[model samples]
Target: MEHDRTRTRAWVLHPEIKSDEQRRVPEPALEEAVALAAALPDLDVVGSEVVRLQRAQAGLLFGSGKIEELGERFHENEVELVLIDGPVTPVQQRNLEKAWKVKILDRTGLILEIFSDRARTREGVLQVEMAALSYQRTRLVRAWTHLERQRGGLGFVGGPGETQIEADRRAIDEQLVRLRRQLQKVVKTRTLHRAARAKVPYPIVALVGYTNAGKSTLFNGLTGAKVMARDMLFATLDPTMRRVELPDGPEVILSDTVGFISNLPTELVAAFRATLEEVLGADLVVHLRDISHEETEAQAQDVETILTSLGVEDDRPRLEVWNKIDLLSSEDRQATLARAERDPAIFAISAVTGEGIAPLLSEIATILQGARHESTLSLTFAEGQKRAWLFRQEVVRSEEQTEDGFEITVLWTDKQAARFAAL
Candidate 1:
């Protein structure tokens, strides 16, 4: 991402609350938060830190002393925005902003901003706006001082539901209803398009993995398409599909989708369900992992958790792809390749270098070939295109040159036969 205008001077803080049972390691969590901040083009990350504490305060999030210390640092640096790497309540946000005199954004808020900026498709844009609206709806807590005043109800007895807050909630609900209707029309069109593709006989392979795990690189390498592949996180936000014919393998529609991260916001998880339906309907799920990262196992686990949450069955056909072997040291690279060789399901490769790709494609071909059937057909010499296509598909079992034209025995799928008949 590139930006020419002025940027927001931001600082990142990963709150390591020890009392939280599901807290991630603060060091990498902070690292990922900084990366997430960097993903947005208009945020100039000025500083970042791991703020460790025994527990979180209900109203202030951090104790007064530490808050004062952080306030002084932000003042000195002129930090315009503060991004908390964990969840922060509306009260906590209001207090922290007042104390530090800077805008406050939690992990969920930051992700929404990135998605808003990167969404390309119509459905993608609608989903991000809906997610952002949902997030803002929660943030409207006591953050709005005027909302505390009574609106139309009795002064003493009936007070809870009669406030400006209720009015704001109604507005958001109305907008959500409008967006949902528009999204329903878009989704219906997409479903029709998907149904048309279903009759084409090509399988769909979905690529899923942690953010910045080199999925787009592998996608470009396989399809020869100019997809945006960057080191930054969430570079590819919408689902990108391309037709790719593997070496001696079936032709497949490869889908590169939005990256998954640890502790994804619930709003986004629901919003992105429609975008990730490709993975649910896929014939094969290819999980790409960045093997060189120190926290590779933890990252892979996060992807698995998201997959399970999406209701992907445990027995679904899948292949674990360990990528970026070239980034590893010589000794580690050898060991990684050795492990991959032992596990037939895992492939170690560098998508950049095109190393270890042939074997992986061969495996995919082997798996898809299970549906193939053998057939004997006679083709006239005049039908040269048909003869050439059979050999190109690598489905030709045998051939004999006859006086009429040629006799060929083929092992192929129903789709292949349909294509041949059309040719």
Candidate 2:
């Protein structure tokens, strides 16, 4: 197609070959992608169609005949970009772009692009760039725009061909190492801050949910912070910590983190682990859900899967928050609420209207207390250092001194309890 480089059209292609599966791609996922794309300010989606291609041409991705047909269609429709809803090998991406004479983005590449566009914070941007560079290290051949060449590192092999590929890989490896080190520094700093907070030991409540499931909105509603609560995927990429007061007059840090998605890229999960450590270290995890969506159950499953993958499955206190209840029909909402009542951890509420949210916060305050360990400690008055240590290490509600030893009652987190027991 002869469109301007800035003016591009997108086509979502789903290859349906001879397979046991009924459909090459699920219709709902495609519809979701289209809806997501329509929400984007840039990049117009001109056409979308499904096609069947020979499995024998898997390496090049599409048969030569199909390539010619797609090329003709693109030309006729003035389409400039082809968005494939499946993974495309670097060779396949290059071959298809060459044959079709248009820019091509596979599912992974398009997702990376979306993340690259959405990321705002320094850490978030770095994580996305790291993923992009890792993905680009392999596709060094096809990504070469002449303009980018002028800027350097243009193609799969910028200047030295395959040698450039090795160099790019090495560069990406170094960058990843650096990023990890930087994130580790951040982690250490956070740990120190958490240690300082441990002197008071207010409970921490973490919000974790599927992308666009209204976590940020709920967090803002609870904390009264304008933390960019937009209705977009990964709107809150950076973790935001805010103090929220409960009905019992106790306040806690409410952390809002990056949203989870189905088939979330493993590389991203690993890259963003440092940020997710807040969730792992939280006193309680609030799993938000868009109760109105048809895929609410599936989305809940996806959130749990991601959390389990992150290794927070066992013993972490969790609460289910069925958000967006206002979007559901009255009957459906009532039925869902009835079902939710049967689950011990589940609560249905609209984050917008604050329905059922006060009780949820009260429950959180109650659960936060249960997450701690109550212990009575014995220490000598001579061991004032130990008393100071106990104060520093555990959340002591009261203390008393004895000739034999000083007995102090403390509420500790799991880790702190372990430390106190060891001492």
Candidate 3:
């Protein structure tokens, strides 16, 4: 027998956005939610509306009358699920569900569900599950009513009318420990691979941008690696790193990280730290922007905001690459070019047509070479390890093996030279 389908009613509760900033809040999220609701196989989205809640009552979220009206509507319309467009606190979520007598899901929950549905890799699944579990731990009370129920196995179990908060916390803590252990293994393996790459010391360039900004296309164009490239939000969740060569005699490792989005969940940011380490350690950061996007400047600012949070804003050399030039008219293209010329660090290019990549790479090569430090240093033959370390870390200019010692002349970063000097 087929299970009964639940009627899902969704409404957007956007935090007061002025008309000016409405463009920043893409309609794709709502559209995606509608599509997801339709494909759920269990729920039907019957209606939706945008409600503006007052800031003071933001805790309860909806006003008392609004809550009563919505609850009545739920009863009248036979709504079994309520989808909220903003974050809902644990207490508020529980209270809302009790009032409406329906399952409630916040914006984070919806996004998590989408990610769960789309995740294909084992690592991606694990990361998403970890984030979901973290979120669920806070709202366990919403899922169960018999908090007074006690089990035989444990002295710590809740008794008569007691909340399951403690037990839920304990359970979540245990899972967190396990997840950390598993993620640690992944981190260790990634570290080993990174260390191995250090022996060859190819310059690394990383691409960072807002979601669906054509990073994967540029990556495929540059490296000839086929990764999933789609014109959808969060199309590529897993970071893909590939080897690329610039014509100016430098081999590079180019990495494309998961795209950033406005108001990305904090849990997601924390869970994906390992994946973003590639950006943190890169020699050059190519900040890709979608020139065709209507909110292109704002999108660029959002990427910079996230990068700043990652502590990469000031230290790393960056190239602002405005992509999708093919979509622009000749006048707009010339305007973009003129803007790029005014900013020495920015370049405009069409990743689709492969135009302007050559100059961008050449500029990057120059920056990478400038990052190297040229210095004269002396080392004893017995310190073969240090000599090898220098070779492993940087391009060695010259080396001589003598009866007493090995003499080397090298170009390296000042940081690396300091490391050699300390030895």
Candidate 4:
């Protein structure tokens, strides 16, 4: 469907709440919020500001004076939507919308909108819809009188209790159940596909990083796949995979996954778990970092937090790819290169320029080589499926046919061995 070219005039506000302990600079946070708002199609970010607050007001979020000031600004700008850079309670959202006479979306809601717009695959679409419904369920705060009605009933066993909000919530819950069932089917298909890949015995190299961290750029550069590499945040929502050949090393499957963000909404985390399981199953994780960003360290920390939450093992093989070196000044670039040189596990490269990629690929090949092992095994004649799967994987170096079965020698990674065992 074609989107309207006339964009929605939107204003973004980053609440610099003094009591909040996050270390992100308010200016960068506001800038990120603006970028996030811009990521949505047909959104013209009219203005953005960091609203400083000594403390948050339970009902309004901001003080009366600040609210009135922002309200004036919104009116002057004719803002159609207000994007908050942090969480806004439903009460605060309702009060602010009433006060400013514009729709308000908190950080979570804005991210959900972006995900909803970007989701492509069946699983991704279903996940986004479920997450949006889950979020909308919380916002059913009698925003409309049509949603405030109570079903007629006696005041006894089945009293006049179920309000419109309750009914809506129930309906949403029902939809969620249905979506979950559909999602499970999609996940099952994905699992079968993953199993098929595992039978190929290719070491999986997963790319993970903060949004707009040049992961897709590096992925395209490395795998030569024309994935949607863009400057926008969350540009690649669906996980993409391609077989990549390493220099003088075994061929491996490289996966580009959804980007991570600081304070990613709980709804997205829960909804995208199936997508993220690819990372969990990976043989090696390549963390791509935009070293040029001022908040690079903080962003890396956020990625770490998300990975930890996803149960990525500390001992998992990982390499850090410090990307976007082209964006840095000469001196800073030299410093980054020097830092990377001192660390065997870290590589500095500009994905856009293809600088330092050859060495990175060589390093990846070396790591995969170290992880590979050769073994011999025998399968009974009854296990013809397993025998054919081995041959299809081409892992069988030599095989001898016997009356009962076939004896085979194969080369595979530990992950592959475990998967075959499970099969």
Q: Model 3 over residues 1-423: C-alpha lDDT tens digits? A: 233454344444333334324322435445544544553434566676656543526457777998898788778777777877667888888788888888888878877876776566556777888999999887766455563444444445554434456667778988988987887787777777776655445678899998778899999888899887766566566778888777865778889888777767788888666556789778889999999877788778888998898889586788889999899999999999999889889898998899888889899888877565466667877788898887776457677777788777775666676777787
lDDT head-to-head 2 vs 3, winner: 2
Q: Count the backbone clashes (under 3 Å) in each candidate.
A: 0, 5, 2, 0
C-alpha root-mean-square deviation, candidate 4: 4.9
Clashing pairs in 2: 140-155, 140-156, 140-157, 141-156, 379-406
TM-scores for the candidates: 0.83, 0.79, 0.75, 0.87
Segments in model 2 whose C-alpha atoms lie over 4 Å from true places: 1-8, 15-25, 35-41, 50-56, 142-163, 370-411, 414-423
Off by over 4 Å in 4: 1-5, 143-148, 151-161, 378-411, 414-423
User: Which candidate order results from sorting by TM-score in descending order?
Assistant: 4, 1, 2, 3
lDDT of 1 by residue, 255-338 (tens): 998999989988899888777888986778999999998999999998999899889988667999999999999999999999
- Measured with C-alpha atoms, the lDDT of residue 422 in candidate 2 is 68
Clashing pairs in 3: 373-412, 381-405
Overall lDDT per candidate, in order of appearance: 0.88, 0.76, 0.74, 0.87
What is the C-alpha local distance difference test score of candidate 3? 0.74
Better model by TM-score, 2 or 4? 4
